[model samples]
Target: MDLVERLFAGDKRACARLISHVENNVNGVNEDLKKIYKETGKAYVIGITGPPGSGKSTLTDKLVKLLRKEDKKIGIIAVDPTSPFTGGAILGDRVRMGDLNTDSGVFIRSMGARGHLGGLSDATSAAVTVLDAYGCEYIFLETVGVGQSEVEVMKSADTTLMVMVPGLGDDIQAIKAGVMEIGNVFAVNKSDRDGAKRTKREIDMMLDFSKKDWRPSVTLVSAIKDENVDVLLEKIFEHRDYLLESNLYHLERKANVKNEILSLVRKEIMERVINNDEKHQLLEDLSHKVALRIENPYTASEIIINELKK
Candidate 1:
C-alpha cells in the first residue's frame, strides 16, 4: 500500500509523516489528499475561538488532558497571528503546550494565520480532514480571533466554542457581528476574575435574544486551575451526542464536504488564472478599469469567465 493507504490502515507514524508533508505544502499534496478524502469524516472537529488574550491556548491544553483520559486519539490545530515582520507564528502556544507535545496520543500543530480571516490558517480545513481520515476521535481547532474569515473557515467544525473574558468593554462590540451567531458554546474564561459573573450575565442576555433552535450554553471556567474543565468537557460531549441524535451529525459532514470541495476549487481556479498570462493581463486591465470607475469587478469577472469558457 502507498503512504495514504498506510495512514488509513492505522499506521500512526505514517499518518504523522503524511501530515507533516502536507503542512509543508510539498508537491503532490493535492493528489495525496484526493486519495484519502473519501476515507475521512470519522473525526469530530471542535473549533475553539474567541477574542485574543481570552486564554484559548491554555484552555486547549486543559481540554487535551481531559480528552486523553478517554483513550481517544486527538489532533489539535492552533492558529496564531503571523509576525508582521517575520510572517511566522509567534509560537507562544508552543511554549505553553510543552509537555502536551510529549504525549504520544496527542498531536498538536501551531499554524500562522498567514493572513487568513476568522483565525484559521489556509490549510487548517485540509489538516482537519487529514486527521479525520487518520482515525482521530477528536480534532480541536483553536482560532486566534481575527474576524469574519475565521468564522467562515471554522464553520466546518462539528461544533464551535466562542471563548470570552471579562473587561472587553466597548471593544466587545467589535466581535458582536460574526462571533455571536456562530458559537455553539460560549465560555467565560478566567471565571475567578471580579467581573466574571457580569460577563456571564451579558452572554446569557445575548442568548435570550437569539432565535436558534438549541440555545448555546455559557459556562465559566478558569483554565489556569483547570476549574470546571470537566464540566466543559461534558458539555462538549453533550453537544456531540445531541448532534448525533438529531441527525445533524450527518448534515454537518455533508456541509463540510461541500465547503472542502468549494475551497479547493477556488484555490485551483485562482492558481490557474494567475498562471495564465492572458488572463493575468486581463485581470490587471480590469483592476485599472475598476479603479477608474469605468466598470465594476462583476462585469470584469464575467468577461474573464466567458474567455476561460472558450
Candidate 2:
C-alpha cells in the first residue's frame, strides 16, 4: 500500500515518513497531501505557545498523559528552534516528552523552525493534516517558545493556549497585542513559582478590556508537578465545545484554510522569484535602485509584479 493508505491504516512509520517529506519539501509531497486532504478535518487541533522558559514542553507532556487516560489517540508536533550552524532543532522537545515515546496511542514529532519566525515550521499545517487523516482524535501543535510574533498558531489551531509562567517581570507588558488576541485559553504554568498570583491578576486586568462573547479563561497549573492540569484540560474542552456549539467550528476551519492557502501562495511566489534567473536579476536591480533611493519599495514591488504577470 502507498504512504497515504498506510497512514490511513494507522501505520506510525507512514505518518513519520510523510511528515519528513513535507518538512524537507521533497518532490510530490504536495500531491501526496492532496490525496489525503479529504480525510483530514476530523482531529481537534490545540496550539501551545509562549516565550522561552515557559515550560510549554512540560505542559504538553502532562497534557498528553491526561489525554491518554481518556483513550484519545494523540499526535504532537513540537516545533523547536533551528541551530544556526547545523540547521537542526536546537532544543529537542521530543526529549522532554520522552515518556510518550513508548505509547502506541501517542505519535510525537519534533520539527526545526528552519528560520520561520512564526515559531512554527513551514510544514506544520501539512504535518497536522497527515495526523488528522491518520485518525488522531487530538493533535497538539507546540510552538518553539519564540515570543509574540508566534501568534501564527491562530491560523492553524482550533483552540490556542497562551502558556505563561510567573517571575517573568512585566509579563503582561511582554505579551504583544497579536499574541493576546489569539489566545482562546490562558495557562499560568509553573504556578508554584513566586508571583504566580500576580501574573494571573495581571492577565485578568488585561483581559477585562475585551468584550468578546466568549471570555478566555486563565488557569494556574504546575506542569512539572502535574498539578491542576486536569482543570486546564477541562478548559480546553470547554473552548472546543464552545466552538462546536456556537457553530464557529466550521467558520474557524474556513479561515484556517484561507490562511494556509495565502501562506502557500506567498511561499510559491517567493520561490519563483528566487529560482528564475531573469526574475532574480530584476530583483537585484530593483534592490539596487531602492538602495540608491532611485525607486521606492512600493514602485519596485509594482514593477516586480508586472514582471511576474509577464
Candidate 3:
C-alpha cells in the first residue's frame, strides 16, 4: 500500500517504520514525504519547550492522559541531547513518558539532537510530517532551550507553549527574550515550588508591556499532582480556535511548507555539489590556498561559483 493510505489506516507499526526511515535520512522517504505533502497541515501541531528540569516531560505525560480521555489520537516527539559517542539521548525522555506509550491512541518518539544547533534533531520536521499524515489530531513536540533555531517549532505548530518554573536562576530570564516571543501560551510548571506565584507575576508584567493584540495568558500547573492541567487543556483548545478565527493558522502553515521546501532544496544541492569530483577538488585546493595565504576566500568563492555554473 502507499505511504499516505498506510499511515491513515492507523498502522502503528507502519508509522514507527516510517519514522525510523526519516530519522535515518533514507533517500526513499524524501520522495515519500513529497508525495504526502498535501496530506499534512491537518494535524494541530503544538510545541512544549522550556529549560532543563522544568517538568516538561511530566507535564507532557499528564497532557497525553487528558487528550487520550477525549479520545484524541496524539503524537509526541521529544528532542533530547545526544551522547557524542553513542548518539543516544542523554535524558531518556521516552522512558520518562512511558505511561503514554502503552496507549494505542498515543505514539511517542524520542530523538537525539545529533548536534543540531536548535536543541532539535535535524529530522524533526520530517518526523512531524509523518505524524501529521498519520491522522494524529494533536501532535506535541518537546524541546529544551530557546535557541534561535528552536523557533522553527513555531512555524510547524498552531500554538507554541513555553514551559517554565519558579526557580532556575538567570536561565529563566535568559530564555524569556527568545521563548517568550514565540509562546502562544505560558505554562508555569512545578507550581508547588516556593516562588511559583512570583514567577507568574513576572510573566504577567512582561506580557503587559507587549503591544500584540493577542494576550498569551499564564497558567500555573503542578504536573506531579496534575493540578490545573484541565485548565491548560482548555486554553490549548481555545488557542486553536483563536488561530482559526484569526485566519493565522492557514497562513502559518503555508509559510512552514515554503520554508521546508527551500531548506530541503538547499541541503540537497549542497550535498550534490560537495560530492562532485571537480567541486571537491576545487574546495580542497581552496583550503590549501587559504592555509598558505596564496589566495583569499572572497576570490576563491567566485571561482567555485563560476565553475559550478558551467
Give the number of the best model, judged by TM-score: 2
- Tens-digit lDDT string for candidate 1 (99-137): 788888887877777766556777888888788887788
For model 2, what is the alpha-carbon lDDT of residue 7? 90
RMSD, one per candidate, in order:
2.5, 1.8, 2.3
The sequence of per-residue lDDT tens digits that candidate 3 reaches over residues 67-126 is: 888899899999888877777656578766777878888899888788776657778889
Report every candidate's CA lDDT: 0.81, 0.90, 0.82
Report the lDDT tens digits of candidate 2 across residue range 184-223: 9999998988999889988887887888888899999999
Which regions of candidate 1 deviate over 4 angstroms?
9-17, 20-25, 83-86, 147-149, 170-175, 292-296
Worst 10 residues of 3 by lDDT: 168-177
Task: Report residue 189 deviation for candidate 3 (angstroms).
Answer: 0.8
Alpha-carbon TM-score of each model against the true structure = 0.90, 0.94, 0.91
- Considering lDDT, where higher is better, how would the candidates rank from best to worst? 2, 3, 1
Better of 1 and 3 by lDDT: 3
Task: Show pairs that collide, candidate 3.
Answer: none
How well does candidate 2 match the true structure in TM-score terms? 0.94
Which has the higher TM-score value, candidate number 1 or candidate number 2? Answer: 2
